[model samples]
Target: MRKILLLPFIFLPVILFAQGQHTLMDTLRAQLEIVFKADQQYRLPLEGMAKKYGWNSHQVDSLYEGMSIRDSIDLGIVTHILDTYGWIGTDSIGPSGSTTLWVVIQHADPDVQKKYLPMMRTAVAQGRAHANELAYLEDRVALEEGRKQTYGTQFQLNKKTNKYIIAPIEDEPNVDRRRAAIGLEPLEDYARDAGIAYKLPASPPAKPAQGPDKNP
Candidate 1:
């Protein structure tokens, strides 16, 4: 008589691998590391161009135009893979993959983000993922689809008008509560990090009353 034992294999296509087991998360971390580096590679050039050609110059616009297509494609492919694999969290993939996923989602175009939002929301609801991803995407989706953002990440300055265009937040009064629920810092802190001057709108001057004139 002989006895045989079988050993488990290290799977490559797993979605919920724990930290440091050479699983799918390694691939995710590797791919996103390259992506993050590529993103940073443009920063110095952009800053130099801004200094030389002016911040709002046509050259900057051209740079953005060229990058937009590549950025969209990169995000599209990555997000598609993510959606297929289901949402992975810090508990499953460890800090590297978790941080990389967050960065990728943040850099992704709003449309791409909206496309993957359902999976992310599911993860949150299932207690496998953090709520911040959902909160961030909710705001991005609202801005792109012309509704109120819930987390307020879509602020921009209109260069021509020299005014801020803040994406509306639903229930502005308790926005901090929503943010806290999702593990985000105070709105003021986030605004400062994003370089926004959150201000209360100034009151308009009262209109002068018109006087009645009588013809004699």
Candidate 2:
């Protein structure tokens, strides 16, 4: 009988610890939900936001598929944001919308909050910047990829001359081939005049031999 009574006492601390952890996690989730919802209000989808952060679209979608906005905003996510972006000002905007939560935390925890508050701000800023840069880089890559697909390797011959040549499109290279298979002069000149930089391929396609070969 005594052992049974003592059993509850022994497990009390464990119970309390579990409860405290759960409460803290719940609180964090609630706060995060607010932030996530606010972000959505601005027309930013979580998938797009994740992509901006350099996350694969599928991975991000899977993570948030069944998660509520509240659950997604947990303490872990907040900490991640803080670690990435620097803490500069609490009132500043964040990727997930306004930094009102930071301000609230500062007001509520004052002394204790000061220690990690800067980290949170820092993470938010860094995360935002990183996402933006990734988005821009992806756009450029997609454009280049599209251009390559649209323009095949062969350059059509439009005109030809010893000193001057013109092609239907620009050919890639540096060779003595006078077949005007989209000569590089226009591209090179345009790049120079427009202050753009580009390099010609090392070898040009060989020009078709003039007339049929005698060696049937």
CA lDDT scores, all candidates in order: 0.69, 0.43
Can you tell me which runs of candidate 1 are displaced by over 4 Å?
A: 4-23, 43-48, 56-62, 158-161, 199-216
TM-scores for candidates 1 onward, in order = 0.68, 0.26
Residue-level lDDT of model 2, residues 1-216, one tens digit each, is: 999999999999999999986675455446655755543442345546675764566656655553444333443455564555444232234333324334223222234254554455354455422222222222233333443211221222334432232222333342223223323233455445544444445765679879877895
Indicate the TM-score of model 1. Answer: 0.68
Clashes of each: 0, 14
Residues 1-216, model 1: lDDT tens digits: 122232233343352355445556677667767766655555547877888999799998777775676566667656765866767766756555555565567677666677677877787788766677667767877777888888766686688978766667777767778788878887778777766767533346679998887767
The positional error of residue 138 in candidate 2, measured at the CA in angstroms, is 11
**Per-candidate RMSD vs. true structure?**
9.2, 20.5
Backbone clashes in model 1, listed as residue pairs: none
Tell how far residue 171 is off in model 1, in angstroms. 1.3
